[model samples]
Target: MRWKHPVLGEFSNETLIHMAEQNGLIFEVGHFVLHQALKAANDWLAVCPTFCIAINVSSVQLKNSGFVEQIRDLLALYRFPAHQLELEITESGLIVDEPTASDILNRLHILGVTLSLDDFGTGYASFQYLKKFPFDGIKIDKSFMEQIEHSESDQEIVRSMLHVAKKLNLNVVVEGIESTQQEQFILEQGCDVGQGFLYGKPMPSEVFTLKLESHAQA
Candidate 1:
């Protein structure tokens, strides 16, 4: 599988967002690309109402001047509720430029868009850092899920994460789940949500809707 992640160095803000919004799965759009995607949606919001689209925001995007204002403008443009839209920020971005990142995130929280810490365990997993931000949810990375079958360490990691999230009152999403065993394991661990090939590999929105309808009536 071509795991979705930013190239780190090659993409410009425009190119990255265009590629992500047009072709990638739900979560791979680079932060720069997502920023532009929101900007692009302003006109659409004026024409027709729709569900919120989750966008990935980078540390660089957070550090930009007027970032919060830009987000506020976009939110205001849409007639939908604030919770309809969500912004996924990588765990590493939280501490990259600590104060700036925090300020920008805090501002967004005030604006009322849901915030999620993406790829949770992949970054600095300190208790202090977890307490620092206002994240509505944590996306358990696929690496940990992939290890659940054979690795004791992975099992412990998932359990530990679920434990902490419960204590903190946060929603947990286990990503990259590809088996019934994985889904059952996550449920056994008390995780709230999960997504993976076991449910269905990522497909176009129309196909996904058809699958949803079939399952709903099944």
Candidate 2:
């Protein structure tokens, strides 16, 4: 979702997405992105059968009654396994029309599609949504990592999140792990999965494929 203008130079993905949302075009944009993502995932799986792709779902898309059916048709079209496609929704996405969101989420769950609550603590009703939604996991927001190594309160907050997630039997993923210290702290706290610059920055599909091939050969 990157865009450049002659006068403005370039716009961030988030800014473009925000503009789309404000213009009431998020549903159309989200659908297109979902389709393209599924196609990309299908292509990637041909190279690495174990690879799984996670896509973010917009609140507008969730509100649409045909959302679940669209996903079903796309998975069938791509011949991709439902379990290999993970749909991530934020707390804010679930807040608008909770019942509708819950129903759609439940159906997706039954269809074997993995669901995750993204940006776990940033929303106002995080815990409430967690209790109501059928999420396979939660991604602790990247903001938590900003000063985690030096801030006791931040560390305690993350520990609390991990503790609650453990009680719910949910997989926990901490985002924005940029250093060995941050990674070690989360690892010591029993978080086994993380995503950040420590691993790699965003790259083109070809670049990622090359890296994968190199790793496989090694």
Candidate 3:
């Protein structure tokens, strides 16, 4: 999500998120992003109905008092299947409001939308989160993948993550697989899904649809 800045020339998604936080409206912005994801998901599913969409949920969005209702309303508005949607929430975000988070997460789970812990290894008390929250998958942070090929320690770290996800009956997605070697290594270690420039750079919905269509045809 890079954007041309009047002064900075360009800003990345992280910078945008950071800027949003400064304004203290990140929660509101997150809600808008979620709805946009739903719209895109609805678009893709219309063409390739088997497609499953994953959207990140910021902690602020999760902690909002009316989040659950907003989600319910959006799901109804989009007519998107709950089973086809997966929400990825960060570990740091969940600690802000445990009881509320738990209740809302449970409700989302009951709604049949899959949940995942994104950037799994970068936050506090990660292992405990797997036990406390109900998630169907764990997204291995790109930092681990960046070193998985060159660093023996990283290989071991990824292996351990896979083992934990396996034991918990959760799926594993390794992001940032920019090379064939990276893809092979993660697959060999039992990772079930992956995403990176090795596949394609991120693009607008129309471009993504074209790529997906070609992939489907292939």
Candidate 4:
């Protein structure tokens, strides 16, 4: 299988987007792919209704007027609450085109869909942008978890992020928590939510559902 992104030319679109979508994993899907996925989700809801899925929203999608319309139409068709769907945009996406990003995110907030800032520290915008935009949560990048024990800078950054989120009253989710120590630290920090391989890898609908059911029962 050719695993290149057909659009960007730099990356295999297949490995980048298609494989994730086909497997029902929560990864980046551009405007075109997201529209199709919404349609599929609507169809899936009829039979399997337990999974709450998230999709990445790129900067280009935000600037387009049709994006919000697409979301509204899909919600009407699927009849799922906005909370069940998450729209993730990279922190860099916010700064690349500020005005458009602000407008688009505001509209999405009005629509009641969850907005998450992915890869929090990788972007140029500082903590100021966090206050400027209406984000529901922030995802701390996995890179921070590296050498956390001896690296005062890394630890301080994480602590600062946690402090900022707490003051802002926004949710914090630490991603890429691959080790037990990382998991324990996040929990100790009183982070509201988390996602990492330490908990479970992304799986198909059936497997995801089973895991959720198990957790509820436990």
Best-matching candidate per TM-score = 2
Give TM-scores for every candidate, taking all chains together and pairing residue i with residue i.
Answer: 0.73, 0.93, 0.92, 0.77
Better TM-score candidate (1, 4): 4
TM-score-based ranking: 2, 3, 4, 1
lDDT digits (tens) for residues 105-192 of candidate 2: 9999999999999999998888888888899899999999999989999999999999999999998989999999999999999999
Q: Name the regions of candidate 4 deviating beyond 4 angstroms.
A: 1-51, 216-218
Cα lDDT, model 2, residue 46 = 73
Top candidate, metric lDDT: 2
CA-RMSD of model 4: 5.8
Model 3, TM vs. native: 0.92
Candidate 4 residue-wise lDDT, 121-169, digit = tens: 7667757677898988888888898777668898888989999989988
**Model 1, span 26-121: residue lDDT tens:** 243443444555554443444335535567676656667677776676566544457767888886666668898888888888889898888888
RMSD of 1: 6.6
- lDDT for model 3 comes to 0.84
What is the lDDT, from 0 to 100, of the residue 204 in candidate 4? Answer: 52
In the order shown, the candidates' Cα RMSDs to the true structure are 6.6, 1.7, 1.8, 5.8
Candidate 3 stretches with Cα past 4 Å from truth are 1-10
